[model samples]
Target: MALLDELAAREAAMRWLDERTQLGTQTVTQPDVANFPFNGQTVALLLRQQGICKPRQLDAALSIRTTWTPPGGKPPYEDVEGPDGLVRYAYRGTDPDFPDNRALRRAFEHQLPLVWFVAVAQGVYLAQYPVYVVGDEPENLRVALALGNQQRWLGVPGPDEVDRRRTVERLTKLRLHQPVFRAQVLGAYERSCAMCRLKHVELLDAAHIIPDGKERGTPIVPNGLSLCSIHHRAFDANVLGVRPDYKIAVRRDILEEIDGPMLKHGLQAMDGVSLTLPKQRAQHPDRERVKERYEEFLAVG
Candidate 1:
């Protein structure tokens, strides 16, 4: 089992590296020789040294390595020689002031893929912020300054675009549905309606205790509840609510004025019954958020 797990990990790494290298090739035009030093041959050689043969295995390993790197600190940069004994490219620290020696040391310590991803992500991040080039302008410095100027005009840092891309990548890995609020709520509820235990994904909705439109961007799961259409509408309109302790409640006004066996069976009968919980214990709604909603429900006119 241990050997199998190790093999699986290696395979995953190979896949990740292949995809990332492809993405880098597609996205980075005339990438700084200092930043992307490894050519195809160099990458192949490195993978061989690490005992990785398959592209898929290389990618998976690189993905894990990239994701695990520390969030902050100067990125690693260095120069690598091609098979022809020519300097193919140089890896430069993302921060111009970052000492190349220290950065390279850290890169070697953690491995190149980790450093590469950090630099790529950081470069995308820094592209968003204002860039000011200082000191007597050498030719290369002047080029960087010109790029910064163009970045400002083009909104090159494009934080929103970068964030969206990162979000998609991360969420994809987690297998999360788009429109995260609903996905998160449904995920917690295992795609079943809390009120009816209806497993029909299409019939269920991720109802917010405080309607999202009203909640002003607070989309925490504790502020959410899973309900079928009828129950969700009822709860949203204040005809039904749940206490912090999980006890169901129906407004006296709704119970008195409504007359139907369906209501009695579906809504009123649910009174005093507890909500179905998530399969995983950790996915349960936060107690504090639930309590706050419960209190607000009580205070509503």
Candidate 2:
């Protein structure tokens, strides 16, 4: 009799879900039956089926609990209430679980769409946010999840392009600032400065090929060049430049100057040299991005 009652309950649950489900075009994936705490995991799977596949392209961060948790037993990722009557997600410091967060951060850096699914007693509510990793504070690394204003985009049926564009810009401005972005870019360059081949982890930075504010700029490894702090600054300030052909160039005025060993070897010696590229050709600096930034450097010089 107990077995029959359990079966009946499962049937009722499936029927309730099926009525509200927006089934995937390719396959109708059903929920897991045997697993305990099935609802939250089930909602996550349904979200995956509802077009959040390809971690490199699209993703969703899910939480069965109302708040997100951080690593090292830190406080839960916070929700800051706004005057606009919406709650925004925020996290600070290194997520000790960074490896697990790679896919989600990759999606954010590329301006790829992502959703958040939280399982509630009634069902699941899907939310979208313009995710960003703001630079660190004295206490911790800061990340923000502003409401993306993407109703239809997150599978909520609505229309508002103005808000969508604004949200996108807000998220795109800090591609280089995120820990995940740094991890990926540094990983691609083998944790060495691409220009100087500096191997010290503390000295290296994930330098963007183009400034983050530019339309074409992104945190993708192909758009990044691992550079040490000084060289990274030089690259950004147009003191050093990289051509699309993978050759390096120091500003002509700086190169011609007679200076001490530091200036001579540090900057001028690298002039007309080839960059140390990633082993994978795909991870090599994007030629178009190099061309764009190189042109800007030439214009400034």
Identify the candidate with maximal TM-score: 2
Q: TM-scores for all candidates?
A: 0.43, 0.47
TM-score of 2: 0.47
* Model 2 global lDDT (CA atoms, 0 to 1): 0.52
Highest lDDT scorer: 2
lDDT of 2 by residue, 181-248 (tens): 56557766777988889898778887888777679776667888889998999998999999989999
Model 2, which residues run further than 4 Å from truth? 1-177
CA shift at 160, candidate 1, in angstroms? Answer: 16
lDDT of 2 at 157: 14
lDDT for each residue of candidate 1 in 86-185, tens digit (9 for 90 to 100): 1112323243333432323332233223212212221221011112111111222111110122222332123356654444333322221113455557
Candidate 1 accuracy as TM-score: 0.43
- Model 1's lDDT to the true fold? 0.43
